[model samples]
Target: MRKHFFGSAERLHLVLMLALTFSTGVVDAMGYLGLDRVFTGNMTGNVVLLGMAMAGGTSLPILRPALALAFFMLGAALAGRLLRRNGEGWSPQTSAALLAVSLGLWALTVFVLLAPVQADPTLGSTVTSALALLMGTQAATAKRLKVAEITTVVVTSTITGLASDSRLAGGKGTFWQRRALAIALIMLGALAGAAALHVHLALALALAAVIATAVTVTGHVAHRRAEAEAKTGAESPSLARD
Candidate 1:
């Protein structure tokens, strides 16, 4: 189990994806509170809100959710195209860095040119669309990584996994630890972002981008180290045989 854990790319990807999930939570909170009542990452929430607005059950603008949903699709489309071109050469870190850098720039623009930009409904919508785009691209790219029971954009399945895979549920509970961590990290991120909003709403996105960038660098280093370790292990076995 130790060798499996150390040798497997799945474990590394899962850890990094959990970080991305936390970033998603931060940005989703930023979108809902700071932007127009939209969820930049969680499409489930956006869909429900869109339905309610259309049903006249809420005062929320339909355009907000519609725009967020549209931009998210656009982002997913962009990721699909990039995936086709790069094939396996493209790593999750690459997509994450793309998103973090773009969002970082957007956050800077909001800070510099559009301080308190959320008060301007039109500009907020535009910014929210951009944020949703990054999130959707990230969601699509992360999906390609093929980790089980965890998606960075939402935790419905992760929660389900945590419940269903528990030892009491007649399952081995193998992923309970990671599943629980995903939920915890997302919740922590939500709390952090909401608190930062009281100070400066843009800080949420900035924090999320910083976390993404850090994970991107960390994943690269971890991948290199795993490769080196695997090579040394392979060589040691061969040397002993020789």
Candidate 2:
């Protein structure tokens, strides 16, 4: 049981997913509290908000969520294209690239947050929208990659999976622990991010960028090693014959 939980590829996938989940929680919390309650990671909430805004029923405008959804789709589409071009083997590389992009965007957001620009409502809205879109894009890309547990943008599906597969529901325990762990990590990250925000918003963004960069580096390393092994095996006479 211990080996199955810790020595499996699923475990590694869960670790990576946990990292992304933490990042998502941090970013989403920042966006919601600091950016006027707009969710950056969860596009579903953003879509609903967009509709409400379209009907002129809320202070939140529709354009921001609309742009976020568009960017998210674009990011997912990009991931799909990469998958088609490189196959499942490219999942790590593609995910790393998307995370790298997300890190850069988050860094830019931090810079903007520290800038001397006045806090105008319109500008705030636009900037918030852009950041939210970046988050959505990151989330969508993760989803497209089908990484085991790292769908870093939202928890609705995770919650659904947990409840639907609970022992009380007469379901097997497969992946249930992983799902619960992911949710917990995300919540913890959100709390940490909120604390950082209380001290400094720029600091929170910086922290998020750091996490993303770390994931990018690790994913790249793992991908290269896997690719090298694949190449080595392909060239070996034994493997070739098989």
Candidate 3:
């Protein structure tokens, strides 16, 4: 039954996206707690921080958040261009983008471990911006995959859907399983991220990168197998539910 459920392409996308969402939570925690309150994944939180920073009172950073937002948009634009012509669901371009995200995270992990990132404020901000850029790429890729209710970065809408679509709201409470799992995984990721931060920021980042790599490899392999089976005129597992 588990394999039968995962045979559905949409369900596979949902699972992979939820995994990425967990990675987002880990890095977001690292960003907020370790990087001067700048959000690397959650743009909404960054916007709020930017607003407070512009108010000109506290030690809130104006440049970090601003740069993070800009780089994030830039990353999204780049991913959009790369994926503009492709249809929805996991594709070669999607794999490429996800691979880039994983590699970028690994690169950042190495830098934090080897470089004096803590000693230089500019370097820390640079790392945060890079993280935001990678997350933007990830977000755009996940969006292109068209997994409903799983954005892989933020959960505000998911939270709203959880409440608004509940039986109490007269809705059928559809997809409450994935929705609730998305919320829980992100919180658990934040907890793990914070705990890892006590050891080293690099460790948290490495964990995120590992998850990205796992998603990329597994999703790509499954997609390829589905496509091959389709070409052979066999019933593709991905379309079994369809």
Q: Pick the candidate with the highest TM-score.
A: 3
Report the error of model 2 at residue 141, Å. 3.0
Ranking by TM-score: 3, 1, 2
Instruction: State in Å the error of residue 193, model 1.
Output: 0.6
Task: Note the Cα lDDT for every prediction shown.
Answer: 0.76, 0.67, 0.90
The per-residue C-alpha lDDT of model 2 at residue 103 equals 67
Q: Give the range where candidate 2 is weakest over 10 consecutive residues by summed lDDT.
A: 1-10
Cα lDDT of model 2 by residue, 25-57, tens digit = 887777667666667677888888877887887
TM-score of each: 0.82, 0.81, 0.93
Off by over 4 Å in 1: 1-8, 85-113, 222-242
What CA RMSD would candidate 3 show? 4.2
Model 1 poorest 10 in a row by lDDT? 84-93
Which pairs, if any, clash in model 3?
Answer: none
Measured with C-alpha atoms, the lDDT of residue 198 in candidate 3 is 100
Which residue pairs clash within candidate 1? Answer: none
